[model samples]
Target: MSATTPNGAPASQPKKTPQIPKGKTELKILMLHGYTQSGPLFSSKTKALSKLLTKALSPAPYNLHPTLIFPTAPHRLRPSDIPGYTPSDGAEGAEAEEDDESDNWAWFRKDEATGTYLGFEAGMRAVATAIADAGGVDGVCGFSQGGAVAALVASALEKPHREPAPSPSPETDTSWLPLLRAANNDAPLKFCVVYSGFYAPPPTLGWLYAPPIATPTLHFLGSLDTVVEESRSQGLVDRCVDPTVVVHPGGHYVPVAKDWVLVLAGWLRKRYDEPAGTAKKEEGNL
Candidate 1:
């Protein structure tokens, strides 16, 4: 059939090419907040970094549009649960409600006596739901506790990363991995970026590092971070099969400066340019 113009005359059609160039590709990334923070708060802190990443990836051959999805942790902390939180004398009711509704959130609670991570599974479940809702994400970036969760998410998506539990117990819930895998349609994450991350000390989660994580990871550490020690971040670095570490002078925060953002953008570009199947081969090597 001929195409008709406004005047009812046949219009010429352009010839089709043998191979059409692909349109702009979306690189969806999950952003996880730190302990005592919410999604919006995290997003606001990383606004500059996000913008730089978007600008770097949105051009020419890359043609990648970076979409960042920030998801708050599911666990809410009580006044007592938060470090250094103190209620005013006789403060109650509305004051309590107001405090509860504010910036107190955690991915998991540390069992002080045993160093176990409580509520870890539930936190991962929330992340899995977020991934499914987004249809999936190419990668994840997190700060503090959320950074630890991001690493765990990377570990969970790759099945071979699981080794026998350090001490297997029937009570341990290892089922979240399947949920995460299914949520991402079994496609392993291309990368993970963690700021002030630490290793989960719980034996139940030891399987996560039974074989160190294979997904390419970029870890940012603070020289004077009092909240999460530099050693803690190094402990996590030691557990990654491939890790690129960046040390900044700041403390316990993601660096939003253009210089640091460019480092991340450069690393991401390299990962994106790697030939297909390289990631799987790297995973198999472990």
Candidate 2:
């Protein structure tokens, strides 16, 4: 049976917890999509990378199978809401936007004036719900806006038992912490990977950065990419206790090539304490 919302409506893309095999652990990764992208789209885009990761981790002392769950954000985005979307002079283009409305989604909308994320709590709730449905996840990965949310999720999971400050306001809404804990059964993520991610600068989000994120983080930056500048990505890297960074030649998208996929596999090996060269050896056989 599918999980439902408090109002009894079916939840968005409820994921089934993958069964763990004998002598092997189930490695669940929550894959969050970027602004304007949906879970299915992200899953399709990262298909190659996902396959490679699974193969890399399947062998020997590292008997791990990765099961990635891509969840669509709760907020729907209209054509006009997209960053580069311009009014169509042609009727066909306008009709296309209206017809394809369901593909566009966002975790939260940015309030340019206050530099805060509007509907941020709803976004967190959506993620927590996904976690609950899946029993829990071992890690998270995201791109662009979703990447920012990935960092927030990792930070929140680190110390979910923490209480809010004496006087809380809209800016500092830590209310989602407990809910997140309950959803994930109080499991802290083993690692997180962010592609084209940025830091939330609003004063309301200071609590997330003040203590800095301790979870192992891997950040990928595109040297020639202009969608999200390097400086912005650096801000996120700076906040991490000790983050691993990989600068790809591409821009604004997750790299799924063999080499890049191996880099990710290597990182995961390090995180899980698996011996090095396991992924490379397995790749050569493939």
The best candidate in terms of TM-score: 2
Residue pairs with clashing backbones, model 1: none
- Provide the TM-score for each candidate, comma-separated: 0.84, 0.86
Angstrom error of the Cα, residue 123, model 2: value is 0.3
User: For residue 214, what is the lDDT in candidate 2?
Assistant: 84
Best by lDDT: 2
Tell me the lDDT of model 2 at 202: 67
lDDT by residue for model 1 (1-286), tens:
5553342222223422223126778898999999988777898999999899988887877788888888777777767677787778776675667653555678789989888888888788778877887788899998999999999899888755464454556777766777888889888898999999998877777778868898889898988799997777888899998688888899889999988898788778777766865543443222
Q: Pairs clashing in candidate 2? A: 171-204
The clash count for each model shown is 0, 1
List where candidate 2 sits over 4 angstroms from the true fold.
1-10, 13-22, 89-100, 160-163, 166-173, 274-286
| lDDT for each candidate structure | 0.80, 0.81
Instruction: State the weakest 10-residue window (summed lDDT) of model 1.
Output: 9-18
